[model samples]
Target: MSGGVDSAVAAARAVEAGHDVVGVHLALNRMPGTLRTGSRGCCTIEDSNDAWRACDRLGIPFYVWDFSERFKADVVDDFVAEYSAGRTPNPCMRCNERIKFAALLEKALALGFDAVCTGHYAKVLRAADGSPELHRAADWAKDQSYVLGVLTAEQLEHCLFPLADTPSKAEVRAEAEHRGLSVAKKPDSHDICFISDGDTRGWLAEQIEMEPGDIVDETGAKVGEHAGANAFTVGQRKGLRLGRPAPDGKPRFVLEIRPKDATVVVGPEKLLAVEWIRGIRLSWAGLPPAGAEAGEEFACEAQVRAHGDPVPARARVEPAGGDPASGGTAGGDPADGGPAEGEPADGVPGPVLHLTLDAPLRGVAPGQTVVLYQGTRVLGQATIDAATALDRVG
Candidate 1:
C-alpha cells in the first residue's frame, strides 16, 4: 500500500466488496536501517507502519515482503545502465513491468491470490469476451496509465486497480479521512523514491563513472566541455555552460549524447523535431488488432512520456532487424560488445514499431516507451529504438 491514503482507501474499497484482502507492503529498499523523512518516501519504516495500521483498522492481515534485491537488480541497476548507454529510461515503467506485475504478481498467484490489486490511477474493464481491457483513469489529470503501459496482455488479467473508479486524488484522500485513516492528509511522494533529493544527474554521477568529455556543436566543433556525456539527455538545454553562444545568439538544445565517443551534441531546437519513431520490445496490453499484419497502418494517439500530450500518429508493426536493436543511434547496447545488465540477452529483440506522427514532435528520446491508444482504450506499447527527424528521413 506504500503507506499512503490512496492504497489505504483502495484496501477499504476491496474490503467493502467482501474480498479477503491482505495488505502487503513491499520493502523495496536495501538499506540496512533507515527512517522515512517526512512524506518523502515509499519504502520507509513510517510508511510501513502506516500500512500496518491501516490494515489493522480494516481487520485484515498485513505483511511486509522483502523485495529489495530484486528491485535493485531490475530497477536501480537498469536506470544506471540505460543512462550510461545514452538512453532516457522510464524507471517507474520498469518497476511496474519487472517488479510489481512480473515479480510481485507472480508471487501472489503462487499464494492463491486471484490478482494483485494496487492504487494506480488506471482502469481495467472486461471486454465482451471477458478479457481485461486497460483504460485511462476517469480523472484525466491524475491518469497514470502511461507508466502502466509496460504490462503485457497476460499480466493485465491478474491485476486490479480499486482507484480506477475514484473521481480524483482529492476524493481518495477525503474517503481516507472519512474512514479514519491517519495518512489521509499525508503528502504524496514526488521525487523518484530512490533519489531522495531528486537530483538525478548528481545521484547518477556518484554511481557511474563520470569521465570528462567534449561538448560540440552540430558541425563537430568543440563549444564547451562537460564532466560526462551520460549526464546529458537528448533534449536538455539548461546545464550546458558552453564556452560561447551561437553566432545568431539563439538557444541550442541537446541533439544527442554519444557515450562511446564521450561527446554531447547541441544544436538549434528545430533539430529535435521528429516524425518517425522506431521501437523495440513491443508489447500489447490486449489482443492484437484483428487481422493486423506487418506494414499495415493503424491510427492512434502516441504518447512518449508520462503526462506528455498524446500526438496524432499512424503505426505499423515492422519486422525487428538492423541497427535499432544493436547500435547506439537507436539507444541499444553499449560499445563494450555485451548486453547491458537488465537488457534482453544479445539476440534479435521483440517486434519493432514504425510510427509516423501526423505533426512533428520535439524532444523525442530513445529508450522511452511509446504507448498507443484509440480514444480512451490502450492499444499497445513499444520501447523506443530510434526517432527520425522530418528532414533526416529524406
Candidate 2:
C-alpha cells in the first residue's frame, strides 16, 4: 500500500471481509536521513509512515520491505535506457511487472500469505473452467487494466484487488471518512511517485549520459539544436528551438529521433501519419489460441499508446522469422534498405508482430506499447518496434 486513500480503504475492506490482513509498504528508495520528509507519494519515508498509521488504526500488523536496489535496476534504469534509445518507455508497466507482481508477490508467498492485494482499479474473474482472467473495473474511467495487463496467470492466481469490485472513487472516499481513517481525505498521487514535480526529462538527464544534438528536417537540414536527444520523445512539439515558421506557418511535430546520429527529426504534420506498426518484446496474460498464428490475419482494435482510442486493424503475428510475404506493407520498401551491420536500427533483432491499420494514425512512436484487444479482453501487447508510413513499406 502507498498510504493513499485508495490503498487505505482497500485494507479496510479486506479486513471487513474477515481475512487476517497485514499491510506491507515497500521501501523502493534510500535517501539520507536528513533528506527525509513527509509526502503522500510512494517510496518516501512519509508515505511509509502513513501506511503504518493506517494499519495501526485497523489493528493489523504492518512492516516496510526494502526493495530499493531491485527497483532501481528494473524500473529506473530501464526508464533512462529507453529514452536514450529514442523510444518512449512505460515505467508504470515496468513497475507492475518487476515490483508489484514479481517482487512483492514472491515475498508475499514466502511470508505465508495466501494472496497479495493492491488498490488497483481492475478485476479478476474465474472462467467456467476455473482459469483466472482479468477484467475492467466497475469504474470504466479509472480502469488500470492496461498497466496490469503485464501480469502473468500465476501472478493473477495469487493476487487480490479489493477495490476492483468497489463503487466510484467518491464512494471509496466516503467509506473511509465514515470509518474515520486518517487518510480519508488524502489526495491521490498523480504523477510518477518517485519523480518529483513530474519532470521526467530532467530526472533522466541527471542519470543518463546525454549529449546535445541537432534538430533536423526530413531532408537532414538542420533546423535547430536541442539539449539532448534523450530529452525529447516522438510527437513532442514544445521546447523545440525551430526559430522560423514553416511555409504554411503551421507548427512542426517530432517525426523521429535518430539516436545513432543524435538528431531529432522534425517535419510537417502529414509526415507524422503512420499506417504500419511493428513491435517486439511481446507479452500476454494468456497466449491466444493456436489458430491465432502469424500471417493468419485477425481483426481487433489495437491501441498504439495508452489512453488513446483503439483503432481498427488487421494483425498478422510473426513468430521469430523474417517472413516478408506474411507481413502486409502499406507500400514498398524504402529506397535505402536495412541498417548497417552491428548498429541498432529500425527493423533490427527482436520478436516481431506486424499491424496494418484500416486508417492512418498520427504521432505513432516507437518504444510505446501496442496493446491488442477484442473488446474488453486483452489479446496481448508488443513494444512499438517500428512505425512507418504506408509509402515507406514495400
Candidate 3:
C-alpha cells in the first residue's frame, strides 16, 4: 500500500472479496530523520502510518519492508546515471520494472504469495488463448500504463491492480471516506519522490558533477554560458539565459546535450521535432504485439512520457545490432531512401524497436520510454536510445 486513499480503498475491496490479502507498505527512504519533515514527497513516514491504520481497520497485518538499498541502486542511481549520460529517464518506470515488480514480487512469491497488488490505475485481461494482456484503466485521466510500461511478460503474471475498475480519483477518495480512512482527504503528491524540493535540475546538479560549458546554436556559434550540459535536457527553452538574442529575434530550444565536450546545442523550436526514434531494451508485457513480426510493421499509438499524450506511429521489430555492413547509426537518418533502410538490409528483427511516427514528435529525448499501444492493449515498450533526423520544417 502507498498509504494513499487509492491503495487503501483497493486494499479494502481486495479484503472484502475474500482474497486473504496482507498489506505490504514499501519504505523506500533509507534515512528518514523524524516522524515528519518539510519534505512532502509521497514516500513519507506519514504515508506509512496511514497505510498501517488502514490495514488495522481492514483486520489485516501490515508490514513495512525496507527496500531502500534496492531502490537507491535501481531507481535513484539509474536516474543519475541516465542524466549523466546525457539522456532523460523516468525514475518511476525504473522503480516499477526493477524494485516493485521484480524484487518485491520475487520476495513475495518466495513467501507463498500468489500475486502482488498495487493501486496503479491499469487493467490486466486474458486473451482467447488465456495469455495475460495489459489494458488502460477505466479512468483515462488516472491511467498509469505509461509508467508501468516497463513490466515484462513474466512480471505481469504476478501482478494485480485492484483499483483498475475505479471510475475516477475523486470517487476513489469518496469510497475511502466512506470507509473512514484519514488519507481520503490527503492532497496528492507531486514531482519525483526523491527530489526533495521538486526542482529536478537543482537536484540533479548536486548528484551529477556537472562540468560548466558553452551553450551554442545550431551553427556551432556560442550563444550563452551554462554551468553544465547535464543539467539541461533536449527541448528545454527557458533557464537558458543566453548571452545574446537570436539573430532571428525568436526563442531557442535545447536541441542536444553533448556531455563529451560539455557542449549544449540550441536551435529553433521546429528543430526539436524528430522523425524517428531508435530504442533498445525492448520489453513486451506478455506477448509480442500484433503484426510486430520481422519485416512486418504495424501502426499503434506511442507515448514518450508518462503523462504525455499518445501519438500515432508505426512500430517494427529490428535486429538488435544492425548489419555490420550498414556501417552504423551515429545519430543520423539513413541516406538510403528505400524501405529496407528502416527494416535493415537483412530484414531480420532484433532486440531494438524502430518507431516511425506519423508526424514528427517534439521533445523526444534519449533514455525515455516509448510505450506502444493498440487501442487499450499495451503492445510493448522500449527505452529510447536516440532520436535522429529532425523534421527541419517551419
| Clashing residue pairs found in predicted model 3 | 318-350, 319-350, 320-350
Candidate 3 RMSD to the correct structure = 3.8
lDDT of each: 0.82, 0.76, 0.81
Candidate 2: global Cα-lDDT?
0.76
The sequence of per-residue lDDT tens digits that candidate 1 reaches over residues 216-319 is 99999889999988888989999999988997899999988888889999999989998878777888888766644444668899999889889999886644
Instruction: Point out where model 1 deviates above 4 Å.
Output: 321-348
Q: lDDT tens digits, residues 1-394, model 2?
A: 7777888888998999998899999888656131222342456766787788899988999988888899989988888778888888888888989998999999889978998888899888876778777777888777777788778778889878899977689988998899888888776765666674577778888887888889988878888888788888878888897975676889998989888888899989898888888767767666563455544668877876556677888886655544466332322224322111221244455445668888888888877888887777667777776777867763
The best-first sequence of candidates by lDDT reads 1, 3, 2
The number of the candidate with the highest lDDT is 1
lDDT winner, 1 or 3: 1
Q: What TM-score do all the candidates reach, one by one?
A: 0.91, 0.89, 0.92
For residues 1-394, could you state the per-residue lDDT of candidate 3 as single tens digits?
Answer: 8888878988998898889899999989876652433435767788889899999988999999999999999999989988998889888889899888988999999999999988899989998888888889999999998888888777888888988888899999988889888888887766788775678999998898989999989999999999989999999999999998898899999999888999999999888887777767778877886556453678888889777788898776654554343443322235421122343322334566767787778888887899999889888798887675534311
Model 3 residue 271 distance off true place after TM-score fit, in angstroms: 1.1
